[model samples]
Target: MSTALLVIDMLNRYEHDDAGALAESVGESVPNIRRLLDAARQQDSTVVYVNDNHGEWTADRRELADWALQGSRPDLVEPILPSPDVPLLVKARHSAFYATQLDYFLRTHNVDRIVLTGQVTEQCILYSALDAYVRHFDVAVPSDAVAHIHKDLSDAALAMMERNMRARVCLTDELVGVFGSR
Candidate 1:
C-alpha cells in the first residue's frame, strides 16, 4: 500500500502554557522525526507536513516556518523544515483531516496508509489517528517520534490508538522499513 509520512504540528512556537513541558519532550522527538524525514525522502515516499497556523490566517508554509523559527525553539524547527517541493497543508485545528485537503490529497495520491510523527502525542496525534481510522486509512505512529504534554495522557492516548484505532504504535526504528519497498 502507498504510504505518506504526516509531520504534524512540529513547526511549533512553544508560546503556549504547556510549551515548556512540550518543548522538553519535543527535544527528544525532533531527532527521530528528522531521521524519518530523511529516510522517507531517500526512499521516494510521499512526505507531507500538516502544521498549525498558530491562528495566523494569512500564513503559508514558509511564513509558518519563519514564525516558528522566531519562537523559542529554532533548534527544533530548523532540522525538520519541510522542503519547498513538499506539499504542506496549514491546519487550523487539531485533526489534520479537519477542514483541510489532507484526506482528498491522500486519496488522489492513492495513499492508503499514513505514518504520523511530531508534537503533542496525546492531542494532535491522537485526533489525527482517529480521523485517519474513520476515513479508512491505515495508520502508524512511531512512539519516539511523538512528543507529549503529559506523560500519563500520552501513554493513555497511545493505548487508545492501538486498542481502539488499531494503529501501529511502535518505535522509530521499526517504522523506517516502511519507507522502503513501498
Candidate 2:
C-alpha cells in the first residue's frame, strides 16, 4: 500500500486564547514529526501539507508561511516548512478533505494509505482521519506526531478513530520502521 504523509495545520500564528498552551503541547510532537518527514523523504513517500488559510481566502502557501513566521513562535513553523517538492493544500475547515482537492491529489498519486501528523489531535486530525476512512483510505495516526488541546479529548479522539475508523494508532518509531522496511 502506497503511503502519503499528511502534515496538517502546523503553520499557525498561535493568536488564539489557548494558543500558548497549544503551542507548548504541540512542541513535544515536533521531533517526532521531523522524524516522520525525514523518513518519508528517504522512502520516497508523498508528503502533502494541509494547512488552514486562517480565513485569508486569497493567501497562498508562501503568504501563509510568511504570516506564520511572523507569529510569536516562528520556531514551530521554521523546522516543518514544506519543502519545494511538497504539495500544499489550503483548507478552511477542520477536515483536510473538506472542499479541498486532497482526495483527488492522493488518488492521482496512487496513495492508498495515509499517515496523519499535525496539531490539535482532537480536531483537525480526528476529522481528517474520518474523512479518509470514509473515502476508503487506510489511516495510520502516529500518536507522537499529533498534538492535542486537551488530554482527555485527545485520548478519546484517538480511541474513536481506532475503533470507529479502524485507524492504526502507533508511534513514530513504528511508522518509521514500516516506512524503512517497505
Say which candidate scores most in TM-score: 1
Question: Where is the poorest 10-residue window by lDDT in model 2?
Answer: 173-182
Give stretches of model 1 more than 4 Å off: none
Model 2, residue 93: C-alpha shift (Å):
0.4
Query: Candidate 1, after superposition: displacement of residue 49 in Å?
Result: 0.4
Per residue, candidate 1 scores C-alpha lDDT tens digits across 40-156 of 998899999999888899998888988999999899889999999999998999999999999999999889999999978899999999999999999999999999999999999
lDDT of each: 0.93, 0.92
For every candidate, C-alpha RMSD to the true structure in Å: 0.8, 1.1
Error of 1 at 2 (Å): 1.0
- What is the alpha-carbon lDDT for the whole of candidate 1? 0.93
